[model samples]
Target: MDQRKYNIYFHTHTISGIIIAALLYVIFFAGSFAFFKDSISAWQKAETHAKIIHADYNYLIDSLSKTTNLQGRDFDFYLLNSRQGAYINMSASKDTTISKPAAIKSKSKRRGQGDGAYFLYFFANKQPTTYAEGYDMGEFLYRLHFLAPLNQIPIRLGAPFGYLLAGIVSFLFLFALITGLLLHWDKIKANFFLFRPWSKWKTVWTDMHTVLGVIGFPFQLIFAVTGVILITNFALTTPFSHFLYDGKQEQLFEDLQYNRTIEVPYSYTSLDKDFDLNAFVSKWEQQWQGSPISRIHIRNFKDQNMQVVLEAKPNPSQRFAGSGFVKQNIATGEVLASKSPVEDANYVDGVRSLIYHLHFGDFGGTALRLVFFVLGLMGCAVIISGIMIWLVARNKNNIPLYKRRFNFWASNVFLSACLAMLPVTAFTFIMLKVLPEINQAAIYRVYFYSWLILSIYLIALRNPSKVNLHTLLLSGIFCLFVPLVNGFTTGLWWWKTWSSEANGIFLIDTIFLLLGAASIMAFWKVRKQAKSFQVLLGK
Candidate 1:
């Protein structure tokens, strides 16, 4: 490449990377942990996914029918991947003759005019709990990856601005990755072999950034593309929707197979036949043996015109496939439309599944997810080193003092914010065990407040190296306590879980054990340097 073009590539990459660095770090870090979200939930709840291979749908419906009137209503059951529980949703009865129940009504402002009940149902324990009671660190970190919590802000730009921001960051990150690859194109091969721990600060940072960035290029690039598409698909498709579907978003989504819309008009006639839902569900389960039923949507329940849509995902181990659903007429016992996941999946299913599985890293099971998590951590390392390089390159006497000061301050803030996440997350896991009766509000308070306090304190130190030191030490201590705390609270230690075949719960404990070990090792090395008053790590 010519000098001018090289300069352009370098500057563009630097600016774009810097612009999204901190936010991108949050996404990557939180997302890395989110790969184990299910395991984390299982671990924290002290439940074993292995024990619950199937949910008792019959018992679930029976339990729900006992509490609420099931006539002429819509019901949705969303099964968790863990198979241990599900989300039970009940909408207001479709029959206008039936009035809203006074027991369920509230003066809540954010609620819609129509009332609905959403709660969690544990299949294994046969118990119901509020959604708040089901909240866990896994869900929190997963939402954090896409900045979903930020949607709580009142600002609306025709859509959720939090997702908009995340999409923008992902797009910019893709741009930076492209420009960076181009900037390093000429020396790519040679750079692959470059590593010098003893080099000057700027050189060390540059080498670390280049090496890890190259190594993680494909994984990062996949996330960048898929993250943007997944988060902003609706927004991005609006213009195309106008052209293709005559401006109907619902039509476009249906056409693209993102969802299957069934508008079942009520006949307003009561059904005389007694339907055994358990026997009905059992028939389908037997038909679709290996595949798990993920969701069921019942419209106009117990009515003559009732319709049930059953959706299921194919078992990837049998054959990698997306999913398909069946729509059935309840009264006539007729199959309205069928798309068997085991036999025929539409092209849209293939495309959507690829994007979903690749982005979420759920296709290949635990081994693949662990590999992806390591790559995600490597992405974090690249981001941190890039920030270090940005600071060191500008920390010169020749640079204006104001610019130098601003650069240093920016680096301090970014490093503090990013590094603090390690210890804060570990701390949250420990707290998850220590706290009694954890819930959504409690988790938010514990995590965000702890993170805020630690970040503010680190920023006060005003040294990037010191931020790294403290975060490492704190991360080591807190992470080491995670499994220990869980054992103390739940009696499910590493040995016990593994021996009991509760691998999902064991996965989380093992992950924290490894992370705690690595952090402590790094902390020990850094502590030794501190004793000698060496600045090698600061380099």
Candidate 2:
């Protein structure tokens, strides 16, 4: 390529990357952890430490039916494969129009606080128990990954702005991926495996960025495309409904079978007196064969015309967005309708399912999730290094001192955002371990305030880079102690957890230990770079 063309590509790449660097880092960092969301949730609740015993599903159902008057109510039954415990969640409202399921409400004095739902827990050979609240560290992190908003905006408008910004950044990310490949096309093969830690800082960063970007190119592309698709799906669906389906959204959904719901007429007589849940479960198992039923939703419980919807575990080979559903008559145990991606999905539906599976890394279990998590972090590193390279390039040019100072400060702000996330996340983990009963809403406040304080410190400091180094060092220390905190609070040490059935807790502790080691190494590398830069500048 000629110098003019090269310059144009270089400038385009740098400009586009800088525009969304901080946001990309935040998204990637949170998303990496989200791959282990369920494990995190289990770890948060210390579910493994709880006394668990095998319970007969039929016995639990029969007991609930006899003990509770569930007439004209909606309820959900959740069964976990890892433990013998089960949960039955009865919503507050009997109205079919109520979309949101009731959560166990907490009695914490904090305003707007509630436990997830009122749930009855069942175990073998023991009386059923109930809980008023549940922790949500995993769910919160998953939401923060996709729903994080700019701090400057009004809180009410944050969601819409955050979504819009995410869509825009994802689109730009796709563009960057294409342009990046084009710019590196000439030397791609030659530099595919190149790395030189002893080289100049900018050179090392450039090599690291290139190697990571190239190695994870396919993963990055999948994330970018799926991210845009997910964010813009509703926006595109609305227009397509209007133009293609005459504004009949239901018609569109029917065609896609995306939001299929089974509607049965209401009956005045109560059927709970004669309903045999064990028979229904047996029929469902017979139909689905090996698939485990995860959740069961009963609409208008006790009513003669009640409908039961059972969602079976997703087929590993199907690669769909959700588990298949079997809708049945609650009174007759008759199957009404069923849909499984493995059995009935059309080409378009299968493609949609594959897209979700690829994006979420759900198909290949823990090994694939681990791969996605590492690549996601590497994506963050790519963004951070790109910004650093841009800053270094600017400093090498003959720019005005004022402009240079502005760039320097801007780079510090960006670096601070990236580095602060580690400590903030570590602190949040520690807080959850130390105060397991803390209000769920308070968790978000802690995370937000910690990030805010660190950001303000970065902006106000005279030597931001030095502060960045110190913050990283502190983050390392915090991370290193997280396992100890968890052990102290839960009495489930890593060694014990490792031997127990709840390996998720053990895995989480190990991850923290490794992350702490990585953070310490990062601190050392940054400190060395700072010294090198100072000597170069004769400071």
Candidate 3:
């Protein structure tokens, strides 16, 4: 084999580097802060911010049931206790109603309320859930870290983009780590902290990138592979599931089957004539004595013989199943199915479920999630720094004008977004709570549009002036004051919530303050450096 055949990899390597570097920065920065999502959410909830009092699950449910006529209705209710965020949401819908049957009689079902119910249904039932053309806050930022506006493409196209980015980035990161190790092998002994201020600008940049890359290599590699596996499972595992299982993915779901019963056809009719919700909730409470039932789903809402699904409250450690569904026959009030294993599932299902939990940090506590979040941020940083190094190295040579311009524009625009986007997104989160008119979908759309528009504008602009640095500073300042904004707008603040178990609000406030302070410092540093450069050149 020709040795230069290795050069073929670099063609894609360069592209991956350009794409991933920009993407990873946004991923790292936003993701790092997202570690405190629960805490931040706690900071925004009015009732939750008052104290660490655990709501009486049983009392709350009974009270909610009394307040809302749940009998003979097609809907379910979920009450989360000690969840560290937001007020009580007693969701009632066809699948969420405990006294009704599922509306969708076929293989697929859609939720009319929170996404958590469908998530529980899929995980508990051990069936795959499909995604539509929308975005979650985390997923949106992650996609921007790579695809950005290219996400307007359909699922078929977007999934491949995810896989390709992951596959190529993993390889390039692996190579860069190996090559960097080899290149630095000589100086490894003497120059661990080698930073030569007297060296040329490019030299300093390369050294900063390479040295940090070397230190963070292990983190980079783990994040690269895990992130790929985590994000593009639809791409990577779907093909494998088809190939290995002959496209019968049901076998893979066998592990998740807990008291799954056969689906039987039933006639459709509204049975909202008469039923006692108070007594029904009483019976449910008696059955799941130790288990706190969080959600109630009424399947086949229009059908008289619909089944009611009462989901168990989540236990922090092993609460991977979004919620447990206990199906009951509406006519007879007899329990039909639940998420407990009636029969043992195969190893594949176990592995698959475990993988999902691992990727999402669902199986872990706050500490584990924090670790995952930090590692993710480090991965983003590695991508940013690595790309910066590549650019600096190339710029040192007599590169062509078009290539130079492209690199300059890509570097500045992408880096600025990556650096500034997190703070901007943080503001959006606060806006979600503060602005009553703003719903979840609206919050996400506005956030996405704002980021996209700003990034495009930055890319079009040729020069970075004081205005650019000021924008960065403003983004951070807004993020830092988000907690205060929440307090003023919604009467929820960190200090007010400190006495309660919702102290996650305090953590959120501190994190924002730290991140905002860091951003402000960085802004001033850049401005000072620009001034020094101008003075030296007599500009």
lDDT to native, each model: 0.84, 0.73, 0.53
Off by over 4 Å in 3: 1-15, 47-152, 155-200, 238-244, 253-262, 267-354, 362-364, 367-372, 429-436, 460-468, 529-539
* lDDT, candidate 3, 1-539, per-residue tens: 24464454445455656765665565556556555554543454443544334323344335434444333234444443433211222233333334543322222134533222221111112232222221234434444444444544554553655445544555555555565565566677677777664466456656666666667666565555666665555556566658888875565444333323334344545665454444665676666544456555555444577676665633436433333456778766677766532123345445544555554564567778767776676566556566666665555337776676666666767666765576567767667665555433565677877777766666555444433575667767777777777677766566665655556666666666676787788787776764321101111
User: For model 2, how does the per-residue alpha-carbon lDDT over 1-539 read when each residue is reduced to its tens digit?
Assistant: 99998888877777788888888888888889988887887788777744545446667656554644445666677775444455666644344443433333334322211222345464644454433244367766776677553433554332366777777788888877877877998999999999998888789889988999988899999999998888767666888999999999888876765554545555667775666666776777777765667777778777888988877755554434445678877677677888762465566666677677888887787889989999998998898788778778777446777777777778878988777888888888898877636544668678889989987786566354566677779789988988889899889899989887677788788889998998899998888765445311212
Instruction: For each candidate, give its TM-score against the true structure.
Output: 0.95, 0.83, 0.66
Query: Which runs of model 2 end up more than 4 angstroms from their true locations?
Result: 2-8, 49-69, 74-133, 148-159, 317-323, 462-464, 525-531, 534-539
Better of 1 and 3 by lDDT: 1
Candidate 1 local lDDT, 330-358, one digit each (tens): 78989989878878876777788888888
Error of 1 at 199 (Å): 1.5
Query: Candidate 1, which segments miss by more than 4 Å at Cα?
Result: 103-115, 529-539
Candidate 3 residue-wise lDDT at 252: 42
Of candidate 3, the 10-residue stretch with the lowest lDDT total is 530-539
- Model 2, residue 342: distance off in Å is 3.5
Give the candidate number with the greatest lDDT.
1
All models, RMSD in angstroms: 2.7, 5.2, 7.9
List the candidates ranked by TM-score, beginning with the highest.
1, 2, 3
